[model samples]
Target chain A: MTASKPISLKDEGLEQKKRSTPMGDALRQFRRNKMAVVAFFIITFFIFMAVTASLWSNISFLDAPKGFKARHTINPAGLDRVDPYAEPGHCARDGLDQGKAWCALLTEEQRARFPNSCRVEIPDPNQRQWCYILGSDGGGKDWMTQTVYGAQVSLAVAFVGSSVSLLLGLVYGMVSGFYGGRIDNVMMRFVDFLYGIPGLVIIIIMQVYFREISSKYEDSSGIVGFIVEINKDLGGLFFLFIALGLLSWIGTARLARGQVLSYREKEFVEAARAVGARDRRIIFVHLLPNIIGPLLVAETLAIPGYIFAEAFLSYIGLGVQPGTPSWGEMISRAGQEGGFYSNRHMIYVPSAALVMLTLAFNFFGDGLRDALDPRLRGR
Target chain B: MTNVAKSEKVMTAPAKKKDYGDPIVSVRGLKKHFPIKSGLIFQRETAAVKAVDGLDFDIFRGETLGLVGESGCGKSTTGRTILQLHRATSGTVNFEGTELTTLKGNSLREMRRKMQIIFQDPYASLNPRMSISRIISEPLVVHGIGSERDRQKRVEELLERVGLNPFFANRYPHEFSGGQRQRIGVARALALEPSFIVCDEPISALDVSIQAQVVNLLQDLQRDMGLTYLFIAHDLSMVRHICDRVAVMYLGKIVEMAESEELYTNPLHPYTQALLSAVPVPDPDVEENRQRIILKGDLPSPANPPVGCNFNTRCPVAIDVCFDWDPELIEVLPGHWVACHRVT
Candidate 1:
């Protein structure tokens, strides 16, 4: 009998069929990856929160209303005459009863909920009736309002700071990697110099310098009520964004530079250069597209960095000023007198927000890294 | 014998008959020395690695000049320096009579369009993140060749020419095997339709059986497209198979140059003879009859090569003159140039 060869059973239907285009295939694979899908949702959730956080609560929750008209102006002495425990209707006029009446006017839930909370009149001509949701700070500004405003400030800062850092790092790294040799050496040396400096100390020094410059601008020649003008004209959101972004780009630049160094030597880059391509074209068209995957992952990881920085700075009282509603500020305010042990919600809410933000960003970053990886894209 | 000398004279005479043509690329007095640095805080340049030391050669039009050498003999460095991939410490590379060393920016890039290089390792050569189509079409896009449709068609054609399914144009480099990826690399090199290519050990990383296929493909492409190649390799047998003329390099200098058939049949340089003797013939009977010359000691450091002849330290037939005065490459016969005191 003739020796017989065994028929292979390894043939699958997918092997016989022509595969779709790589871009389409990559999209399909990305969709199939459950972790990546979940991460996409998480990223979407954070972005939605960041964009529409004010809409979820009162728009003015973090700010004093610009144009509020009061029904009556109360004398400060009159605030002392009111009985603390008297029934709402039996209260005497122009006494502590007014404060109690104002407190009682709040929903029954609020009355039973925050006992220390009370309404205060900002005798300032601009603001009228101000109710403290979590009570006032040492400056008698509404802590709840400040905390809400602080969210706007802190979140804006994180986003802006992270973006700036990402841009700077990507540019620096790509330049270093593309040119290499002496150029790489010089740029890397500068990076090392920056890295050697203590980050917190640098931030402190920068803040002190900027703060002085700002105060100078505020105090120069009494030009149309400066501090009040700046407080009104300069949104805390803008300051936070610019500050965090400027301080944060070095890390991203280092990552980009390393990736570019390896990538520039690859055959594809040589191919492009061989075609009489300009250096700019080779860098942007050939090199940059390959690096975007890593950059995306790096930027995503950097969001948490931005958040933590904002929280740390705010905790140390350099983050947000009074009358801003920031999660970090809320946590800071709550931590005073160890309120964390009693009013657990005060600590948990902002803490949970920060945690969720960081976790979401990390998940998205990991997903993006995998998605961008060429090896992972195929199968 | 008097008869042997006459035979040597006869062998070298007709070998010079090959046309030198208008030399397409000429590299003169090329030197690339990588500095060896010391000290922690302030790095001091202690010495230099003579990667490509005082090399001179010319590539005539439409000829595959095989650069055969041992590892670290500066074959690859020579290729890179010729392409200006490494800025030469001091050298002049003239491409189509244009002084390449002095050309900067746009002019240099314009010159590069006429020449390209294929790397050794297929795995690392192509970008892992880029699609085959992108990789192939990148040259076209960079040079502003055509619109999207024309570029697409060109990429597909190049892919097909390299024996890959044109449909795989969109696939990433990692999706392909070593051979297939090498084909993709070849396709990328062909995209710009350059006249000259530096085949930098193109098939060294491939399987032995697959190596022949790639070599054949390169030969076929060269014949059909009239492409000139500087095929650099450590494999002597493969170089013999593809090269028209072969230059064997030692350290950073060309030790011997002759037609492939002439070099194989009658090697003048001792190093060349030793190298040819080391190749394993396929037939068992011939292999048994061959005398393998096993040279002692590892190759000396390129940073500090031995004085006089670089190969004298390893030469099987080294005379006192081999150690006293370093030999210059001079035509022993009309065609064959050997840098050995014995040969001249």
Candidate 2:
């Protein structure tokens, strides 16, 4: 026994004194990818914008109407508001401001002081005036402020929805896979039944009905009432969470179940059983760590889908509450009105933002999969 | 290089056989059948792979009972079924005195303190994600045998006991070589101080040079701890040196059993004779001169084995009775048992 007992330092000398787990190594690999790093920073910037959405609305130069959530006009005298549709410089050429004194030359002095405040371009180069920046939707809301604040509502649905789905899918898949028999059969059959029904239609119906029911019960004093009031305060994002979370987990559940089923029969599990470890311990401690990598990659890639689902719902005019400034709602309101033909900026600005965030998530998810799974790395 | 060569020299040199005490583990009609279910809508059990059709053997205390067979012959199944790792289709495995087949939940776990298994593939058996310390101490932790501090000490002790450096406990399974990982597996099996161990082809996956060192380490551990082993292997020579008695299996049933040296020199069953003849002797003169009895035909499927003797399909010498009536393993010469109608 002594002949084979010596510690070979040369072989083990390659190992570091500090033991970093596989997850740590995967994180390091992910950091090394340039596009993934760029995507991560872009996503982080969106989250930062999301967190400071209210700050943008309050600090803008345009006199944002007090206590008005949706509309942002330039001043109290906005009724003769340059007639945004008729001509770009309708107020400026020959002083046709309807005898309003400030509109003539006093506004010219204010424009000279804060030139960056106006982002809208007038077609007339001779007499352009300061106006709504990034143009205005039909509702008169500023495009820049709407896009910035829309991140709050859009991101809330993205995060809370996916987290809820991940939770439910993990528990459902683990139970179904770990106790595979009549129980697994019954649980999976239920999922298959749910799969047969069109998921988007059900979510739409649920969102509409839940909003009605919540508004009706918001004053009562129980859990339902508490949830209703919270939903109202959250700009109807609570019901969005419930709708997206309950239905979207079906795909994740299927993914997780497959991962669990494959790892359940591996020799390490049999080894754990032979050591007298209980079923619960084997599933949670031993089985979970091995299967978690692929599940995580799948979830990351699925996040972009969640963001798009919210956008789709809002685009059809059923997304968040009315006053909540989601990019989808802005696009829907813009395009549904005559703004699609009249103002090009209103449609493309939010569309560009929507495209950027979702693309970043997709890129980051791809990089994560390659980092966590070596077999998929080069390919 | 000299260490491996010297150990190889010692391994092939047959050790003195010693007397064993009463059976520490006994099996009665052990069977393990894996059902093959087919059909899409209405699933039905069409057939079964009778891996261990029916086996009856005793692994005595302080002795190694080697179970040898070709790949599909159910040697590993016999060992796993005895330990209740694979639930017996129908049989009793009495470990010391407790009937292991009926035990479940905490009762089976408590009884598992007396028995353990060493898996075949060292890489597959140890979880890659877990550190080496966690792997070796897992059994002790599961059985609630010691406190956290105590388990750490025990892990180090077990590591060193299996001829591994205790300092390497923090490293993962991928860091170690095949021989070292096998030793780590050995350490895990020995964690709870089990009296009986099933070494399931423990050295087959190691290098030829590393194989000798691991085999010698197992021998040393056995002598010092007085542990019983159901050493399952395909290697006839390695089994001869390590095992006290050896059993030869064919198509899901044990065909012959006797002292290792006796079974090798005087094989009663035709299948065992064919198996031993296939092992080339080291001495060229004797190996060339020896009459080789190469049996014809591949082994019959265990799912639908031929009637009468399980080995009758490939058996070299067969009588008319060997095709109809199944022969029971009966003692032909006091300690030597053979299941063949042709055997007296």
Candidate 3:
């Protein structure tokens, strides 16, 4: 007898099923886009790195060491006596031989200036200063630990700032687009006025105002009492984020406003209105969902810009003071040694990290932008 | 003067014969004029766009009343105003026994449950992002009816009733063809089991073949569900086929109203006579025999309609009386209404 294929599922009894939830359909569609999935993974990796900074960093970055003395400190007298280019204890190594070799390169006048150098140097074994894995700066602090720890603070500011800006922009844009007319005019005019000001000037003003307040609190109370009363801990970072976000969100507000204006004219909005859905429901539920894709893309693209700004500010000594380890501080150190060119490692390491982080955000943001675009779907 | 009196006598000598029960909807002296503001900051009302200048009609129970007009004739505006979609500047829209214009909040929504509208573009009428089931279930959800399972079952029934496969309920509007999408729109409108529907040129955007199917489906639904309709279209041929009574509109006012067959067979008003003569008869010989009454000039702007009869500027048979005083809508025959000084 000929072998017969078993009855198929469709033929057996089951009927085709249809999706009941629109949310499920949208989520399924979102998952099918490979670039969006990759972006999701990349974002998750950065978030993981940010949250686990303590485990990654060699030093406890959160705790600022106030009284710890350096194991090695160069004395001013020693600076004059010792040859700057010679290795540690090289002055006493075979006294005349190595010292003469170092001196041979010098002119007769330079040798006369260092008359007592040969007797002044004392031979010492194992006299090397502490070396970090990524090597120490001129101040003998590990850059590897500092940079890893710094990522947390810089990333936090960018995320928090973008989030704050997104929230404010959404509210302002939605209200303006929904109410329209005079309310829209008044709100948009304020946004336009804010946009007219120089961004850096606003940032500087905010930083100075915050600094003055903190200083006033410090002066009113002792440092310990001030820490208790003013309570500037991570709270300070949050406040800074809020300040940056509030000052920098005009662009996002305008973009969101334009989106809402177009979205409000769509047939779905009219249908919602005709159905007697409240103004709030129509604005928030009907119109907002349609514009969320653009907003999300805008927010992702904004993160790297904010990150670069924060790093640039820190490089100029205007951001994340001395105690906080930042990529900008690492870069500043390299440049301080007469333009970080002599020690290329110092410059490239932090600069490379910053470039990598910014590019990762941009690449992922581009992926999200493509995935979120309604026109790019199904293919 | 003697000939005018003789014509008036001829107009209303016939006794009343048709009465399709009492009217479920009635509008009287409805007027909506929107002012034209100029000069921005030093704004002033320059003029007014009389969107629905003055309209009076009665939609009888268990009947489809077709309102036919060209674009800008305020047919859609009249429907919207009657439905209270636009807060009328001044009008009385009495539905059943209650007034619609004065009702607010829950009462108005309750009124909406009894009456609904199917829009021109099927693609736009239903929310594209919402699933077919969700789109159909919206009115039910908004009105707070039944449990989720019961609502789902009802949605499926409505889908089947409108001749759509129930399995397609999960699909977004974009997934369906234009005809299927229109069926989904019909299903959504039928979900509430409303007594009256404003078919606002529902099939105007569809294929000619699909238009007939939709019109037939609407008629079948009307018969099966005992639903009434205010069918608005610019197509006179379709109006004659589907409507029990037809009203012809020009500019912002109804110029003539009569039984569909009678209106097609004999149009009294000059504009109506011209419009009916323009529709080509399917029989070529008869079409050749007919005299086409083509009028001069384009439709007058609703913002600045003629001072007298709205159609006076374009009417081929317009007289001196047509340009002096605005004619009022009045019944000339037992059931037919017309607004023209010459007709009286």
Q: Model 1 — interface RMS deviation? A: 9.6
Of 1 and 2, the candidate ranking higher by lDDT: 2
Q: Give the docking tier of candidate 2.
A: acceptable
Model 3 residue A325 CA deviation (Å) reads 2.7
lDDT of each: 0.71, 0.78, 0.72
Residue-wise C-alpha lDDT for candidate 3, range A1-379, written one tens digit per residue: 0001222335423245454244554455667766656656766776686666556442321112221111222222233322322221223212333444566677788777655433335455236232244544555344555666667766787788788888888888878877876678778889988988888777767766766666567556665446524335542454457558876677778778898898777655665556666676776666777777788778888888888877777788666655566677668867886434555666766787788777777766776666667566556
Steric collisions counted per model: 21, 0, 0
Interface Cα RMSD, each model: 9.6, 2.3, 11.3
B223-264: candidate 2 lDDT, tens digit per residue: 989988999999999999999899898888888988898898
Best by TM-score: 2
Q: Which sequence of candidate numbers ranks them by DockQ, best first?
A: 2, 1, 3
Candidate whose lDDT is highest: 2
> What's the TM-score of chain B for every model shown?
0.93, 0.93, 0.93
- Which number leads on DockQ? 2
Report lDDT (Cα) of residue B145, candidate 1: 85
- Where does candidate 3 stray beyond 4 Å? A1-40, A59-136, A219-231, B1-18, B34-48, B277-297
Candidate 1 chain A weakest lDDT stretch, 10 residues: A1-10
| Candidate 2 off by > 4 Å | A1-4, A11-19, A61-135, A211-228, A337-342, A374-379, B1-17, B37-46, B282-297
